[model samples]
Target: MIHPPDRPTELGPGGDNAIAHAMGVAADEWTLLILRYALQDGVRRTAQWQQVLPISSAVLASRLRRMTELGLFSPVEDEEGAAYHLTPRGAALWPVLVCIWAWEARWAEGHPLCLPRMRHLVCGHQFEPCMACRTCGGLVEPREVTGSFGPSGSWPRSAPNTTMRRRSSGSANLGPGFFPESRALIGNRWSAAMLGAAYLGAHRFSEFQRRLGAPATVIADRLRTFRSLGVLEVLGDADRTDRHHYRLTDKGRAFFPVVMSAIEWGQRWFLAPEGPAVVFRHRGSDHPFSVLLLCSACSRPLTGKEMTVD
Candidate 1:
C-alpha cells in the first residue's frame, strides 16, 4: 500500500508524532514565501510578511509557528532581534523551487504573477526554465520513471549514502529526467500527495486535508517543503483572518507533467477493479483525459534506458 514516510504520533519531527506531520500543510504557500524571501533577502521579519503578503496576522503566526516548530527556520541573532533563515529542510527545497519556477516561465502562458524574470544559472542565458536530464541529452518523460524514498527518511533525518534503485514500469526504456536525486524527491509521498492535490484543485489547507485525508502536520510540512522549494504559493486572503489559502505557483502548476506521469503509473500498477481513482479533464471541452510524456525529438513514448538526462 502507498503510505507516507513513517512518523511518530507527536507534534514535531522527533518521534511518532502524526500531528507534527499533519501541520506541514500550512507550510505550503505562506511558509514557502517566507523561506523564498529569506533565500533572496538573507532574512525576513514578521512585519515584512504583514506588509507584502495578503496573509492575516493569525494565519501568518500560525504558519511561522509551525515552521519554527518543525525546525525549518530559526531566528538569527541580529540588531533587530532575529530573522528567519533556512534550516536543513528549508535548504533542501532550493532545487525543487527552482524547478517549479522554470516550469512556470516555460508553460503557463509566460505568466508574470509574482515570479522574477527568468535566470538560467547553468548557461547564464536570460530565458524561461526547462528541465533536462544530466546524464542524457533528452527531456524527461512521465512513464519512464522509477524511484524510492531516497537517503533521507524525512527532513529532520539524515539520508543514507547509496545509489537509488530503479523500479520497472512500462516496456519502453525510461527517460533521463528520472535522475537519481530528482526521482527520489518526486517519489516521496508528501511531494506526490501535494502535486496530486494541486491537480485536484485543493489549494487551501482545510480542502487539501479534506480531499486527501492527510493529517494537518503532514500536509503542513510537505507544503512547507514544497513552498521552500517553490512548488506552491500562499497568498494572504483579504477577507479571511484566521486562514490563508494555498495555490500551486506557475512553477507548481508546470509540475502537472510530473503528476500526470504518476497518475499514469498508478493506473498501470495500482488501479482498483472498480475504476481509476481520479481522471484529468480539459477545461475548454470538459473532456476527461490522461497525459503522456513523449519524446520532443521523435514524439515516441520514452522510457527506461532509451532516455537520457541533460
Candidate 2:
C-alpha cells in the first residue's frame, strides 16, 4: 500500500498558481460527486451521500474531510446528528455536476436508474446547463475565441522533476483507489485530446483526425466509442457523410467542465517556456478570461480557507 506522503493528495502545482492549488484540493474522484449530492439532492449527512453514491464509508469520510478542508462543505447541526451542506463555494459546483449528469444521461440512456427529470425554473422545462461566456452569454465554444498567456502560464518553464509516473490515466504515481467512471472515460491521452478538439469546434471526422494527428484507425476507434457512449452523435441530415459531421450531444457538451478543468490545471502546472498553447476568450472583447474557480455567492475567487466544515 502507498503511504500518505507518497500519494500527494494536494492538487495543482504549488506556489504562485493559486487556482491550480485550489483545483488540487479536490482532485479526488468522489469529492465532486459528494458536492453534487449536496447541491442537487440536498444530501447533507455523511450517511446520505454514502447511500446515494457508490462509495465506501472510509472513502466517504476521508473525502468529506478533504472537501471540508477545501471549503466546499460546511457543517450544520440538526436534530438527528452532524450533517454537511454546500457552502456557496461548494454550491458553485452545481452547474458542473448538472452538466455531468446531463452527459451521463445522454450516454447511458435506458439504464433504468437515470436521475429524475430536471426542470428548468425559467422555462419550466427540462434543461441542460451549458458553459457560456460571461461576456457574450454564448456557448463556450473553444474555437471562436483566442487568449494570451496568464502569469501562471508563462512561469514553470517546464514541469520539474517529480516522482509522478505519467500513465494513460495520468495518475499512476498519484496512488490508487480513485477509479471513477469519469477517469475511465478520459483515461487515455488521445481520447481526451479528441474531446478537447471537439469542444474547440472539430465537428467532422477529418477535423478530429487533423487536430489530434491521431491515425485514422485510432480516430475511427475513438469516434465509434464516443458515438456508442452518446458523447458524439452523427449529424444524419447535414448533407455531409454520416461520419463527417458528428457533434457533441447534450452529455458531451455537459462534459465541458472536465475538459476545461484539465486544461485549466495544465495552464498552470504544465506549460512550455513559450507560454500557454491555447487560451479561450469571448470574441467581442479583447480581454481574455481564463476559466476561474469563483464562488457561487459573492463571485469572489474560491479558496479552501474561506469557510469551515465539521
Candidate 3:
C-alpha cells in the first residue's frame, strides 16, 4: 500500500475510511477546476488563468501554492516569470475530469458554463467515460457488487451491514452506509467554491483570495490540510513563496471520482432551477457523451439499488 509519508494510518478527515478521506479532500471545487484547466487548456500562468476565468489574484495564488505542495504541478522559469505545469501524477486525473463533464452534460440541465466535447483518442470517436472493472474488464453493476469494511473499523453506527438491490429481482433496496461516509469534507461551501476556482486555472494567492472572498486564514488552513494529507505539494525552489507552484499527488488525483460522483448526484437530486449547470462532450468528436459508473472488478455499471453490501 502507498502510505503517505505524513499520514501513517489515519483515513478520512474525520478518521473514517481511506475512500471517505479522499472524498473529503477532493470535495473542493476550485481545486478540481484548476486541475481541469491544466489538463485541458494547458493554462500555466497566473494572468492567463485570470484572463479566462473569474477568480481574483489572491485566492488564486493561495490555491496554487497549496497545489504545489501536493505535487500536482511544478513551477518552471518562463520568459516573463514562471508557469505551473502538471506533473505525471496530476495528469492521471484526466479520466475523472471527463467523468464529471459527462455527468453534468447528460444529467444536469442548463448552467452557464459550456462543456467541451471530449474525444477518446483510443477509440478515435467522441465518447463519454464509463467505469469498468479494473480486474475483469467487465461492466460493474450495483447489484453484483459488495464491499467490506477495512481495518479502520469506524463504520457509522447506523450502517453496520449494507445490502444491494437486485435488478433482475426487481427489488430496489439500498442499505445504509451506501456512501460509506458523510459529505462533510467536500460539501463545505467555502472549500467547494475554492476548489472550483482552482480547477478553472487560478494559481496565484491573490487570485485565489480575490475569487473566493474567503478569509486569508481559511484559505491557509485548507491548503495546509491538503498538503498534510499528501494531496498536494510544492514544486521546485520557487521564485516567490506565495507565487510558488503547487501540484497534486497521486492521492489527490485519485479524488477525482468523488468530485465526479458528487456532480452526478447533485444533477439528479439537487439540480439548479435552470437545469444542468454545464455540459461535456467528447473532446475529439466535439459531440456530447455520457458518464457511467462501473465496478473496478466486474466492470458492470453500478446503480444505487443494484449494489450489494457486505
List model 2 lDDT by residue over 145-180, tens digit each: 554434444223211222112124333222122233
What number of clashing residue pairs does each candidate have, in the order they appear? 47, 2, 81
Error of model 2, residue 121, in angstroms: 2.7
Cα lDDT of model 1 by residue, 127-153, tens digit: 432333333434443223332222212
Residue 159 of model 1 has an lDDT of 13
Q: TM-score for model 3? A: 0.48
Residues 49-149 of candidate 3 have per-residue lDDT tens digits of 77655556886887777666545668788788989988654554455445555544443323344445555433334455455434444443322333232
For every model shown, what is its TM-score relative to the native structure?
0.41, 0.54, 0.48
Ranking by lDDT: 2, 3, 1
How far does residue 96 in candidate 1 sit from its true spot (Å)? Answer: 2.4
Q: Which candidate is the best by lDDT?
A: 2
lDDT of 1: 0.45
Per-residue lDDT of 275 in model 3 = 31
